[model samples]
Target: MAATTAVQTKKKKDRTFVTTMKRLLKNKLAIFGLIIILLQVVMAIAAPVITIHSPFKQNLAQSELPLFSEGHFLGTDNFGRDLWSRIVYGARISLLVGITAVGLGLAGGVTLGLIAGYYRRLDGIIMRIVDLLFAFPGILLAMLIIAVLGTSLVNVAIAISIWSIPTCARIVRGSVLSVKKQEYVQAMKSLGASDFRILVKHILPNCSAPIIVFATMRMATAILSTASLSYLGLGAQPPTPEWGAMISQGQDFMWTSPHMTIVPGIAIMLIVFAFNVVGDGLRDALDPNMNLNQ
Candidate 1:
């Protein structure tokens, strides 16, 4: 009977996962967002094969060339570096920062969240730490961390991850508190299972939906924040081909070559927008009230 019940529970979860995917696919904006994200990933991965020129090499003779003027399709930067190649390569850094930040935040936050939610004794301490982080705005916190750590692509990602941890922890803590009261969780508790086992095998799985949705949204914010930091000279320093660094470099030549700013700016906006839309879609998909038929 116990094995039968466990099998039934697994089947139910599988059905729920399937339903969520169906609803997500039905969302037109979400589908578009997924496409944009996939394309960016492809662009980042294929940067070497797709790029037309060396992102770092400069040609003084072709300096500040306008878009579509000649061999330089997106045109050259102020130092005569290829804009298209720079943009292609920049995708690698931007995507790397976003993914790494989110991964780090999720790892730390989920552990802290599970501890706080499962152990009443630790809740106050963990929550107090989270509250302290919440005292400052995320960007301000990120800036402070970056200042202390110094600037680079990896450091920028770490800073953003630090700021993002509290939000994920809070979200997961809430989900855990709510999930703990469910019948299934109570069933596990009534059994001879240990607290860790119940929390890991039972509670955490149920909380994954919210965690996933929040992570998606947070990824967009992470990308934007990292770009802002790079623009301000705190991330992926000179000649690195990062989007924000590229935009910063092109600001002076904006009037002479608007494509310089326009190209990378659009890339940043599109990727961020994609993540936001996908997050929204996931939120709806995960909602129990969502009517897939509707």
Candidate 2:
């Protein structure tokens, strides 16, 4: 009997997974976004083999070459650095900063969020701290953190993560508040389950959808913030092949070498747009009320 029950439970879980996947697949925008993300990831990973020229290599004599100029398909920057190569390589830093910072923020934010939502006594204090962080603009907060921590790729990632943490915490706390009152959670409480068990086993699982959606959306935000900081000389430094820094360097020569500005700017926009649409699709798919299937 117990074996039959276990088998049935497994089947049910598998069915639920299948259903969720089906829903996601039905979302055209989500599929489009997924493709964009996958392409960027591939581009980032295969940067060296695919890049036309060494992103850091200088060719002062060939500087500001126009687009579609023989070997330089995307042209060269003001420093004669290959714009195509830099853009391709720049994907690495942008995606890395986005994914790493979001992952870090998820960790700290999940902990604080779970604690604040589950523990009444700590909720106010934690949320107040979150509020304080939010009072400053998100990018401003990131810049402030970068200013204090000084600049580098890792420090930039840390700064972005710190900025992201409060947002994550607030999203999770709201989701948790709704989840904790669910029937199973109350049943767990009534059956003498510890708060930790109820939270970890019941509450958090139910909150996963919103957390996932929020995380996806925040990745784009983090990327933009990282790029902005890099542009402002507070993130990746010179010759780093970072998109924002590339834009910063290109801005001065925008008239003669517009490709320098346009290429990187387009890259950032495509990434952010992809993630935003994916987040929207996920939100729609996850919400039972919104039918993705026509």
**Best-fitting candidate, scored by TM-score:** 1
Per-residue C-alpha lDDT of model 1 across residues 51-90, encoded as one tens digit per residue: 8789999999999898787888888888899988998888
Q: Which residue pairs show collisions in model 1?
A: none
| Alpha-carbon runs more than 4 Å astray in model 2 | 1-9, 291-294
CA RMSD, predictions in order: 1.4, 2.0
Candidates' lDDT values, in order? Answer: 0.91, 0.88
- TM-score of each candidate? 0.96, 0.93
Compared with the true structure, model 2 gives a TM-score of 0.93
Q: Across residues 1-294, which tens digit of lDDT does each residue of candidate 2 receive? A: 979967997897677667777788988989999999999999999998897689999999999999899899889988888888988989999998899999999999998999999888999999999999889997888888888889998988898888888988998998888888778678778889998888887788878888889899999998998899999999999979999998898899888778889999999999999999999888877775554343
Q: What lDDT is reached at residue 127 by model 1?
A: 98
In model 2, state the lDDT of residue 155: 88
